[model samples]
Target: MSKALDHDPDHWPRRLVAVTPVLPMLPILIVCALVLVGLVDGSGVTWVPLLATAPALAATTGGPRGVLCVGLLSAVLGVSLGIRGDAADGVLAVALASLLVVTLACAATSALRGRRERVLAAVRSVAEAAQQALLQPIPATVGPFQVAVRYSAAAAEARIGGDLYALVSTPHGVRLIVGDVRGKGLPAVGTAALVLGVFREAAHDEPDLLDVVARIERSLARNLGTDDFVTAVVAGYPRDGQLEVVNCGHAPPLLVRDSVVVPVEPVRPAPPLGLRTLSGETPDLQVLPFADGDQLLLYTDGVTEARNHDREFYPLAEGLARHTGDEPVDTVTALHGELLAHVGGRLHDDAALLLLRMPARTEAPAPREPSGTVRVESCSP
Candidate 1:
């Protein structure tokens, strides 16, 4: 039964391939129809045979090469047919002109294909290099945190885009950033890279989370386009079980405790980084009490904005509630898969998720007595 279904003629690709043989014959069929309609007499024989070459030529050669090959073959066949039919001057002139036109067109199209291929190759290389340098890998573990991150670009074939995530261990603590630039493609990627680059450097030098964010903002404003901006959440763990977060027009991070999800409310959110001129006030840092076994989820708008066929936006919190538990990596992988399924296997915008879990602390064992001197005799032994 499966083999029969697989071999069905209704299969899409099979049907397309089945039609391939007829494609080369279509022009010849058209010529025959025209001849039957008395479009021309025996003089049209040369043109009819030449037309038959069109489909085969198109199929075998692409751009200029195919056009040229078809034109040359058509001209040869036309001349042969013309000689056999004792064609008139008018017929011979028309055949030669048609061949010349076809040859020129084929040459132009082939040149165009070559140029387009080169441009596409260059763009692909740049995008790949940009992804490597801007989207640094987020280790499965960082500091006292177990981490997992998933990133997807809206543009197919591109693995990275305007959305960015970075997690690094610095002298201060574990610092991370999850951000989305305001646009897409090369421009957006440039801004994202700039912001992340600055954040990584500042996260080490600055003691305060807000200072790190400010540094990123300054760098973006200096380097990015006038209208460009980045919405982001910058966070740091200060080795004191407290998570410091600064929200800059980005979604609030979620805190998962005991398998229940709660959004970390921003005390005050400043406008996105590049808009510092419009809103001068800096974002106020909020300290969240993060105990062992707690997990924090940071994500871009792509997660919340994904919609199903019914056009209903995905309920990330609800999805998280249903799938995520104590394991950070498992929770993230499950949510990422669910999110993809919810969106019908394709995301319309770039999506990114970062999960960090603080493992439950183990109590320290009692200190051992000095081995050499601590022989309290064999009291009980």
Candidate 2:
């Protein structure tokens, strides 16, 4: 029989609960010990009320039924302790009141925990909706290329990160962007939203790729903080066998031709968007041949900066060369898995990867003859 899968995501919590499977009755044992010691000491019924520890512990690890059982056990033993010690009426009353209070507090704790969990589930739903809005999913194929996108946020609870990516087919061609904002959480997300909003509108309207970038810069300048900026790579496929790229202080893109990968570093580096005043330089557009069977990888610095236990960074280019091949989806999936393994299955930063590969060419058709008949036919006929 095949081994059962523990990391099936859907059963993450279930699996952990199953693995430990400890009884939640340890609190009962603790209360029994305390009561025994109190009885051993003559008339020292003061420790009886400390049996409250039972309910408190039970509330954490036990369900409502289990908590009730523990609470009843604590009360019964506490009352027995008061009677055994021949305690005064006041002492007995105080002990009974203390146990009652503990039981009530346990009930309240369980109720609040359940309420918080419900609220957390609702918050998770909202986060998923917001993520879909911020990063519109990329299709598996666009234009003459196969495409794939892999994204992971550092904050596991957030489920979405500052990294942003989008691919849209426009009159200009298949234009896409991958970027990282300077900060994290909602503010970074807002900046990403601003960039994608402007990029989408600009990509469709502006034929020149650089013009699209300018629109985004202007949007960020108007809305973003003085210290905030986004590092991005904007790319387009305006025609077969050609690519247009603009880098805004982001990590260099990787290009794979014939299985040899190389970084396409910017020829003229410029400051990230929203800091154009510091550099006073418009980003340079790079035009290169993207022949058949070539692949382009766009990513954020998270891929490069991810460190292993020894503090060594993951080798992105080498890893791509090893994992990537003909299919963009398979390549990216394998590379992403490897990336997670390299970081011990959790990333400390938001990482994103977009792979685009032009499919191999099919045979060309034979040339067609001219429409008009030849003026002079060959001799004979």
Candidate 3:
């Protein structure tokens, strides 16, 4: 059966409290009320026939054990009501038979539901493990830059998605890549994993930033389908005072200098990662002056393409400009909160944002002379 996975780990407490303790006993309460009505009315209509409702209702909220308990209690209440109302023996027998059938059926249903829940839990556990292995977390700082990243998957249960980002400090310098796969679901996830694997490996091996990008493109071309391609930006700080960026059909990264936000558009446009062969164009490496107090923000299309109810796309560049701060973590947090607010709390597609900031360099003070040792000073009169 195709149904929504309504299990949310965040709201499980509220859901449990709503359905437990009080709700499970509702069936017994109903049976008691019906018994009181039958005894008070003394009608020939025989309300004992309604006893089957107790077990049927129990199936909706409680488990198999609770359903059986409700069914047994209802049968006893029905017999008492029957005797008090002077009902026929055949009527009481039929009520008992119906209650028995309903209770057994409800018990079976509860068991089936429990099994499905277990299966869903197992699947969710495996998904979490896969997410940990595939998309490892990045620390707050890498190399000489303060970094922060935020990612959201459209599938709530599947926390990982096609959008990927990684930052590593290598012998050459700090290397990073932020990219988005062309689609969603398992296929897109596979493509994303492939790209990240190559990037991480090549980021360490290849000294040149463009060579790292080329290695990723070569791997994707061999493994990915003809139509499948990834848009990415590969960046590196191979030496002091320089930032090398290679944009492969991805959105231009926002460069923040002295709290001013500017998009670092590629000098030469290039096709996406896997489509270089078809486009017949090679990616260009652009090196910029990355002085202290300069910041760069790399992101996927998901951030820029996200739309609100009025169908207006998110203004990422403007948001960064407004929320720019000295700390990368604070800047990314503000931007993420605004993005969610813009989309009305949930994004329709995977979104990733990575911000790296170069802290202002400070000069150390000169060493002071010891106070205990008195030095003879010659003064010219």
> What are the RMSDs of all candidates, in order?
13.9, 13.5, 13.1
Residue by residue across 160-228, what tens digits does model 1's lDDT show?
678888888999999999999998887887778788888889989998787888788778777877788
Regions more than 4 Å wrong, model 3 = 1-22, 25-57, 362-381
**What lDDT score goes with residue 236 in model 1?**
92
Enumerate residue pairs that collide in model 1. 64-106, 64-110
**Candidate 3, TM-score vs. the true structure?**
0.84
lDDT of 2 at 306: 87
Candidate 1 vs candidate 2: the TM-score winner is 2
Candidate 3 lDDT (Cα, whole model)? Answer: 0.79
lDDT of 3 by residue, 285-360 (tens): 9999999989999998878988878999999999999989876766776776677667665677788788888887
Error of 1 at 277 (Å): 5.3
Following a full C-alpha superposition, what root-mean-square deviation does model 3 have from the true structure?
13.1
Task: Tell me the TM-score of model 1.
Answer: 0.71
